[model samples]
Structures are given as structure tokens and as C-alpha cells.
Target: MVHENKHVKNARYVRTVESMFACPVCRASMKVVHYQSLICSNHHTFDFAKRGYINFMNQPVNTKYSKGLFEARRKLMTEEAFFEPLSHAIASAIHAHVAKPKKTSSILDMGCGEGTLLSTICNKVSSRGIRDVIGAGSDISKAGIAMASKNYSDKVWTVADIANPPFKESQFDVILSILSPSNYAECNRLLRTGGIVVKVVPRSGYLKEIREVLFHKATKKYSNEATLERFSKHFQVAEHFRLCYTTRLNPASMKWLVQMTPLTWSLTEEKEMSLAEEISNQITVDLDVMIGISPK
Candidate 1:
């Protein structure tokens, strides 16, 4: 099978996602023009890169989530099914929240890093007979969007700030934020009336093994109580689900697990080798899934 070039591959994503985009400068409605740029009513325009993703920022912003980090995460998740359970949970929540599964729906994944979680959930939801669904993802990191656009060309991938997303108001049916920062005000504005927001945050036990390996103390306590409190200010508090699971790991998968996380990204080759046995044994994934809605 022949692989399409970036231009051809991204053309579809560009079209599917164009309607939701607004002018970053003026916040006006935008449309795809000449298949090369997105033009708004006020005349501010953003161009599509050769790879087909749009750059909506006036200037580049630096972030720690580099190409290497995203690549490592993609490899780890794809190969080991690290976040498979979370993806399934998110997809199920979306399905349940949608009043009409057969009708067209749209989802925006805020701060999507290399698009694994969002891409997986979107594909899985479609497989369940939700055929007319569109997925879009944005991140402030250019490297993150570039990696995501390359792998998942079917979804809208953009290099823009998640705090002020470059999208139209009331355009999305569901918004997903998994272990990523949230701009509650923008999320509230972007969702349609009664739209659902599914946000996953780390619990105290999350990645305890890796934390122990690095800090020698995984006993520290943490809480997301403040996050829920803040979220309630924007949307009615719905339901919160706690998912706690333990994963057994082999040497190779464990290597990716430790390396892919920022906590261990600084581990020297020698240090990693020395601590290999301890970190490679097992890990815990403890997270809280909070579902919210801006009541109509």
C-alpha cells in the first residue's frame, strides 16, 4: 500500500476540523480557503503547514513536552497499552453523555500530547457505531502537534494555547482532558449547552513505583480536591469515578514506562541501569475521572 504524503493526509483532517476553528486574532468564524489557509469573516487568516496542521499562535512557546517525550509516550502506550483502560473509560463516558449516538458529534482534546489517548478513544467510540464523530486536539507545544499530526492525520491537530483555544463557541459536544491542564473558562465557552467535560487527574498512588525509584519516597499524599472545587465553579458537578489498577511490567515495557514520564526523564543511563530491577517490577495507575456539565 502506498502512503500518502503529509499534504494529502492532512487535507482530510483540515476539512473535518475547519468549521470549529475561529480567527485567533478576532475570534470570528473561519472557513477553509483554497485548501491552503483558514480565513475568518474579519479577514484574519491562519495557514496550514505542509504537513496539514494549522499554526494559530503569533509566536512559538516553549514547553517541556518535546518531540522525544511525545515519541516515547506514543511508543509506550501503543506497545504496552499503558493508557488503554483510561481511553476506554473516556469513550464510554462520551457514549453515555451523548443523547443521540447516531447523530454527528464533535470532541476536543485539550493539551493532547501526541494524541494517543484522544485518538484511541475516538477510534474506539466510532467502532461502537457512532459513525459521524469528529475529533480535534490542540496543544501549545509545536513538537507535540507535529508528532500528533504525523501519526493521527484523521484528527485536527493544532499548535495553539489550550488556555485560549482557537475554536468557535458552543461547537463541541464533549471535551476530554486527561492528566492535562485545563482552561475552565474556555472549556465552558466551547461546549454546547449541557456538553460534558471528562477530566482525569492523578491520584496519590499514581506512578508510585516510578516516584519511589526517583525520589525514594512514594508515600507522599496528594489530593485533587481543589481541582474539583474549581471545576464546579464552571459546570455542575456530575459524577466522579475512581479507577485504581496495578500493571505488571517486563523489562522492556518497564523501560519505556520509566523513560516516558517526566519524573524519570532525567535518569542517567547509568542510574537507570542501576535502578532497573526496582523500577521494572510493577506500577500503579490511580486516577480520578470527573464528569461535569454546564447545565442548560
Candidate 2:
């Protein structure tokens, strides 16, 4: 048996969902041309990289996230199964809210760093018997999207700005924002009627152990009240679920956790090591999942 290259595999998958895309430059409809590039009516074409991901940005953008950070995140997510429960909850919400199981359901993961959560949730949804699911992920970080395309070939990955997503309006059945920044306006425009948005935000107790060690007393407490309020303003809140658990990680996993999160970005190498050592083993994960319906 012969194995297809990433370019061939990604092109085949993109053809199925070509109509979902809009030109990032002209906002015109786009179609896959010659199984190599996506060309719009205005002839603005975006080529797929050899590694199987399309870059939709007109100009390159710099982000703080690096290749090493995404790699660490993937290790923790896949090897440690640190986010298995949260992934399960998001998949369950999608399964419950998606109206027609027989029809092909389109899902977009915005701010999908490394694409692990998107791939995991899509797999879970498929396992629940919803086989006809189309999954796509986009992030501003080229590093993240590159890792995602290399690791998860089944889904379409793009390096795109979430604020100005390169997709047609009302194209998606479900939009997922998992512990990442969100663009509610774009989400409102991208979701089809009867579609749902799953937005996950961290609660005050989320990673409190690390916060206590790294932050001052005044800055240690975190809250999502503002985020929840903003989400409710854009869509009707349908269901809210809180997921909390404590996971004990080995020293290596703890090191990855510190490297993966932005909370440690400001810390010096010495401080990061100190914080990691102080946290020891047990860490708390507290999050709230919000299922929202776009208002008419």
C-alpha cells in the first residue's frame, strides 16, 4: 500500500469544504484550484504549504507563543491526558446541541493552539455515532497551526486571525473556544442558525496553586465574570456547566505545565523553576463551559 503525502491528503479534504471559505483579502467566495491553491473570484490565491496547512494571512503576524510552547502543550494534552474531562464535556455539549445527527456537522475551533482540543473533541463526537463531522481549526500562531497540521491530518488547519476569520458567514454548526481568547462578533457571523457556541473560561480557582506561588496577593485571584457577561451580550445563554478536578502530575509533567501556560511568561528562569518546584504535584483545574445560542 502506498501512503499519500500531506499535500495530497489535505487537498482532498479541502475540496469537500471549499465552499465554506471566503477570501481573506477580498471577502469573495473561494474554490480550490488545481488541488494546490484556493483562488477567489478576485484571483487572490492562497497556497497550501508542503506540510498540509494553508496560511490565510495577507501579512505575517508575530505572536508570543513559540514552537516549544505548543510542543509542551501537545505533550501534556496527549501523554498526560490532562484535559480529558474538559474535552469530554465540550464534546458532550456539541453532541447534545447539534440538531441533526445524520447531516454533516461543521465545527470550527477558534484560537486552536496546536489543535489537540479540536481533534480530540471531533474524535469524541465521531465515537458518539456522529460520523459525518467536519472539523477545522485556525490560529494566529503559525507555529501552532504547523504543529496541528503535521500531527492531525484529518482536519483542515489554517493560520488565520480569529478576529478576521477566513470563512463564509453562517458556515459552522458549532464554534469552540477553549481556554483561549475569542472574537464574539466573528463567532456571531460564522454560526449558522440553530448553531451553538461552546466557550470555556477559567474560574477563580483555576490553577490557584500556581497563582499563589507566582502572583502577589492582590493579583492572585482570577475571575471570569466579565467574560461571561460579554458572551451573554452576544448570545442567549443556554447552559452553563462547571468542571473542576485535581490532577497529580509527575515532575516532568509539572515542568511541561509551567512551560505551556502564559502565566509563567514574565517569570525569570530561576523564578519559573522555583514556582514549578513549589507547586509540587497536585494542581486544580476549574472551568466553566457556556453553551450559547445566537439571538435572532
Candidate 3:
């Protein structure tokens, strides 16, 4: 058998994702105009890269997250089993909320840092019984999308912003925003009727150990009450699933965790350097998963 080049495999994947995408400029339906490019009626086009992802950004984004951080987070997320529980929770939520009419479901993860959560959740859901689950992830960070596409080649990955998603109307069965910001208006616009929006927010105790080590008084106490209140305004809150647990962190994992998060960025170099040794302890994973829907 002749082995297909990486670019050829990626070009084929482009066909699978065409229906979900629209021309970011004209909002027209996109087609696989070429093996390596997607084009819309208005002639707007985006090219698929050799590594199996597409860059659909209209403008450059300057974010606090860097490639190094995303790489580290991906390592902990997949190899070290950091967020397996949350992945299962997300999979279960999708299974329960997805419309019963269709056997196949399409899911999109907004602000998907390196696509770890989406990949893990979709894989789990499919493994259990739902073999027709299709998952895609998008983020403003090109570096993050690059890593995601390289590692999780099966899922469609793109570089796009949440405020203006590059997907068509009624394209997705579920939209996931895990530990990331949400644009409810855009999410509602992209979902099918009775489609689901799964938003994961951090609870008060999330990463409390790291917080305690970094700042005691000046740091704002964690809160999601305001966020939930905001979500309720845009979506009908169907369910609020909470996942709170503790996981032991070794020095290596702790180092990556600290480096991955932006919380330590504000600290002085001396404080950050001095605090590294104290992170080898149990850390809390407190999160509230909100399942919501737009007004029908």
C-alpha cells in the first residue's frame, strides 16, 4: 500500500469540515474548491495546512497565552490525565442534551486551547456507544490550533475568534466552552434548534492551593455567581453539573501547571521562582458545567 503524505491526509479532512464552515467575510456556504482549500460563493477562501488544520482568522490576536503554555497544558491534559473527569462529564452532557432525531452529532469547542478537552471528550463519548460523534475545535491562538491539529488529527481544528465564529447557522449539535470565555450570541447563532451550549466555569475553590501559594489577601476570591447570572440571561439554564475533586501533583506536573496558567504572570520573578517548590501538593478541580439552550 502506498503511504499518503501528511498533507494529502489533511486535505481529505478538509472535505469533512466544509459544511460546518462559512465564508468569514460574506457568511456564505463554503465548499471544498480544491483538495487543499475551501471556498465560498463570494470567492473567500481558506487553505488547509499540511499538519491538518486551517487558519481562519480575519485579524491577528494578541493574547496572554503563548505556544509554550499551550504545549505544557496539552502535555498535562493528555499524558498525565489532568482533566479526565471533566472530559467524561462533558461527554455525558452531550449524550444527554443532543437531539434524538439524528444519529450523528457535531460538536464545536470555542477557545479550545490545544483541543485537549474536546478531543478527549469526543473520543470518550464515541468509545462508549455514540460512534458518529464529530468534534471540532477553534481558538484565536494560531499556535494552539497548530498543536491541536498536529496531535489530534482526527478532529477539525481552526484558528478563529469567539466573538465572530466562522461556522454556518445551525451547523453544530453542541458548542463547548471549557474553562474558556463564551460568546452566547454567537453560540446561539451557530446552533441548530434545541442544540446545546456547554459552558464550564471555575468554582471558588478551583486551584486554591496555587492561589494560596501566590497571593493570600490581594487576590480576588474565585467566583462564578456573576458568570452564571450572565449565562442565564442569554440561555435557558437546563442543568448545572458540578465536578469538584482533588488531584495530587508531582513536581514536574506542578511546574507545567504553574507555567501554563496566567495567574503567576503578575508575580515578580523572585516570587515566582521562590514559590515553585511549594506546588507539589493536592490541587482542587472545582468547576460548574452549565448546559443551556437558546430561545426557540
lDDT of 3 by residue, 28-76 (tens): 9888755777788888888887776778887788887888889889888
User: Which parts of model 3 are misplaced by more than 4 Å?
Assistant: 1-3, 217-222, 267-273
Off by over 4 Å in 1: 1-5, 269-277
Looking at model 2, which ten-residue stretch has the lowest summed lDDT? 214-223
Global lDDT of model 2: 0.89
Better of 2 and 3 by TM-score: 2
Residue 238 in candidate 3 has what lDDT?
Answer: 88
Show the colliding residue pairs in model 3: none
Clashing pairs in 1: none
Q: Model 3 has how many clashing residue pairs?
A: 0
| Model 3 residue 258 distance off true place after TM-score fit, in angstroms | 0.5
lDDT per model, in order?
0.82, 0.89, 0.82
- Model 1 C-alpha lDDT per residue in residues 1-296, reported as the tens digit of each score: 99866865676557766777888888888888767778899988888787778889899887767677788789878988988888888888877776673567888999888888888988888887887778899988888888888888888988888777898899998898888889888898999987899989999899888777678775599788998888888888778889888888778777666667777667786776566567747789999999898665
